[model samples]
Target: MPGARLTHEDRGRIAAWLADGLGYAEIGRRLGRPTSTISREVARNGAPVAYLADDAQQAAGHRARRRKPRPSATTSDGQPTEVVRGFVDEFATLLAATGLPRMTARVFVCLLTADAAGLTAAELVRRLQVSPASVSKSIGYLEAMALAVRQPAPGGRRERYRIDDDVWLRAWQADTGAHREIAVAAQRGIKIFGAGTTAGTRLGRMGQFFARLSEQMGGSTLAEPVGYDALTVLAALVHAGRPLTLDTLATALDWPRDRLTAALDAIQLHPAIADPLVLRTTEPETYTITTRPDRLGPAQRQALEDPGHVR
Candidate 1:
């Protein structure tokens, strides 16, 4: 009788309790398991329409049998590891507080942790421990909000979904654009509160400033030689001193993989550049300036202007 699982009656009762909108703690009290254990068991096995006790028990057993250890592989004193975890925990909490679905928040958080090189749906399924259906639905939610995107992976049949630098830029710009959209609404608020009054004038000014700033930012994004999104990813990779694959670079740049790949190829074809800058890998190619590159800095700079110039 030891370690006996919940019975059929217990499951139906839990289902009834959930239907009645009882919280997990309340259910735990009734079932004599810890709240988290109850939560996990239900999360692993039960769906909205069905919460069969026998099925849940069997599912839990199967999971325990097959579960793999997900070790925290990042080492201590690794600043990126710490920073990434901070970003993940903070964003996940914020998204939940904002009433976004948990899965949707998770997808966004994944992209953020990657610093704009978003994951593929397959990656999402593996990392988030969610079903394909949930990932699909969550991605749709993200896409509708323009918070996520899909881009091609290098040398691959599968497309990798991503959140580029522009996602945040667009969100900021959208907020700024809203200032112009509902000026009438602001005016109405102004009138109700009295236009000349301090609060109303402040509201009116806010609308004006936002409208102006949005236009400036939008133009800046367009005029910049490199997309701000791409720049950000490059900065992160360089800062981390990590080797970057073409897909990683492409995702970060928000450029097509082929375009960046072609650029790298051009650089390599020029023995001047390739001799100094080493390609890290070829399959999903990456490059980094070798010690040789450091030594050739002056020559490389001159060669930038003169194609034949490599000393």
Candidate 2:
């Protein structure tokens, strides 16, 4: 009951308390909630003077309904019922939101949720109630992304399209490959624009960001390269200017302990990062950033050793 959502009755009480000129802290104390919770509730529901119990309750109901998925229904023959169709459409809408073509998203969802044997083009057309051309075109798009594949149907000339077990893994790899290509193109732009120009500098940063992103995403097959997460951890340590324990890094980064641990491990192993800046384990689980003593190359070290040295 302590963490349960505030009810309509709670809203009524909040309205009454506000009308009586009660402060958020006082209201929260009476309601057994944190002051911040009470403040946010009141602020979102038109704050103190304008807040109404009935209006707030109705608005909250609408928000809750929108957050939840529609209830699913099934038919006796294992065919999708109207409710199922509606849910599929809703899911397709969400997929379309992520830059996918609407028809392609709809077709992909059908293949993803279909039976193991998969669906023929005619079956897909009937289920989706769309044109054959649309289904064919969408299937083409799905195939290009490695999200779906065509296989020969049993005892028939026609082919069936289905999502494979490794479809999502393949899709992820495809995305990472695309990122690598973009990074390469950006690097080309930097060379063409000349490194000293502002455009080249901007392209260089973009190239590095995409390259790092691609490396992070594709690092499962290769050696784990220093990624965005590891870089972020190093930045946090540098900014802190003091040793920070695992718990402190977790709290500051708002990341899980396991994720932070992985990033810290990556920072320790990356050779490129080992030269100029070292991630030192000062305490058992505490870390600090410090300069590496042998950071300079042989020539640079010699130059530093002898102040008057010249090439």
Candidate 3:
């Protein structure tokens, strides 16, 4: 019975046991199921105080229907089913645990597993069985986070939601930037509270941690699998062995001034997380980068190599 699912009758028994003020173990013993199964069911449905037999049964039925294999998603048994549906479902749940909203994670995972052709809003609605508004919310969240990119369909009439091949990289960048922002907030706290106080000490440590992470990630651009345009600018800086002014760097690269500026802005943010890989000073407005990630430990080196390190 450890692997058995609870039936409506079993749910009734649980409700009765709950009414009797019995614990989760006693309820599971009476139902011929493991205590963890009972606990999981109640936790998934609602908290113990508000648990209802009917509600739990209904929720269970709903989940089973959701897990039903569709023609498009065939299981290994050769039955028509949703391929990797359980993986995506469980992955979304895991992301939710990491602070991604349940619906947003579901939407992200949906687009992630969908074909390279991507899915339009209507298609998402039909597949997820959610409303247009829900699709909008989920897509909006992902777009804001730079995880999902929306493109016009071939007909140019509808927009398709797609998780790009660079989704993990973009997600990593965005998550790491969030840490930098958190560190900035901690720095602000230090200013608000006296630096000598306990609160100030905690804030100082918080800022240092995030700043170190940011630095390590920033330096990762030099590691293997580093081909992004921004890193090209850094490579140039490292080769020069001396700080180059923005105007000079732009002139040498034959890149637009705005492009150089944007690249520098992105690079400078890394200093908050760790040692400044790219340093820009107002006194001369020059840029400097020295390749040093090779000297870092394996953990630090891997963090640079992994695009999803922060997330």
Candidate 4:
């Protein structure tokens, strides 16, 4: 029932319903159709005030007659048929409606539905019937967003653009990265606008919302919450190249002692960083990063302690 075409009787009922001042939702409810279906029907077949069932039915017939007939057989190289091409265009239009650039959406869809080997720019250009420049620009945009990647075509200078199996995962990660950036920028705005001011309060709420969203989407999957402050502390420690006392870190970072302590605690708790690189507590309450000994074999550790023994 969902995908079934609207019958002539259905169109006549829609016209009568409109005349009776029934909204799309009520009309859809009575007809057991989706609200969007009713809305699109009315929009394309002349709007509510001007809608006539006879005229709308006639237009629908004309449009169907103009549509290309699908072939019963496949092409020589197993390329997409006319019907599949039509579907590609329709799907691309839906993707574009969701904020992706039109050309980019088309290119992305083309790559998505392509063979596992993928498609070269020339192939994409020929398939989409667009200029080389349009294909090139769209591929660049897709690559930048991690939605597509380029692999070398066998025995040729041409590179194939492919939608990886993990493309959606990469895209989700990129979106979460954008959310974190927005949260950070909003936090900065709060500082600039004065914490007690109306603007600052607005920014504070916005910052908190994005921050929570980012943590919910990105942080939960990770070993621990590695936020901006923790990252800043890690960067400072990495740059310092030696152990540093808490007072020294406070002075170098210009952060409150409690804030620095919290960041250090987070860094220590984060297993992703802790495995390859460890957060160490040195003498006199100093902190430093070192290789996690558990990651290395005993011989490897000994070799590092006495490099001459390796030979």
Best-matching candidate per lDDT:
2
- Worst ten-residue run, lDDT, model 3? 269-278
Measured by TM-score, the strongest candidate is 3
Q: Where does candidate 2 stray beyond 4 Å? A: 1-80, 221-311
Candidate lDDT scores, in order, read 0.61, 0.80, 0.73, 0.79
lDDT of 1: 0.61
The parts of candidate 4 lying over 4 Å away from their true place are: 1-80, 223-311
Cα-based lDDT at residue 167, candidate 4: 89
Per-residue error at 134 for model 4, in Å? 0.9
* Cα lDDT over the full model 2: 0.80
Better of 1 and 4 by TM-score: 4
lDDT of 4 by residue, 21-134 (tens): 999988876664557779999999888999999998898899889999976644335754555556666787798789887667878888888889999999887766666877
On residues 1-311, what C-alpha lDDT tens digit does candidate 2 reach at each position?
11236788989999999999999988875664557778889888996999999999899899898896876546445664665566667788798789887767778887877888889999877776666877888899999999999999999899999999998789889988998899999999988999889999898888877876675567553343436788789899999999999999999999999999988877665524433678899889999998764445688878877979954
TM-score of each: 0.39, 0.50, 0.52, 0.50
Question: How far in Å is the alpha carbon of 213 misplaced in model 3?
Answer: 1.2
Clashing pairs in 3: 73-81, 73-82, 73-83, 74-81, 211-272, 211-273, 211-274, 212-273, 215-273, 215-274
The residue ranges of model 3 lying beyond 4 angstroms of the native Cα positions read 1-79, 223-311
Ranking by lDDT: 2, 4, 3, 1
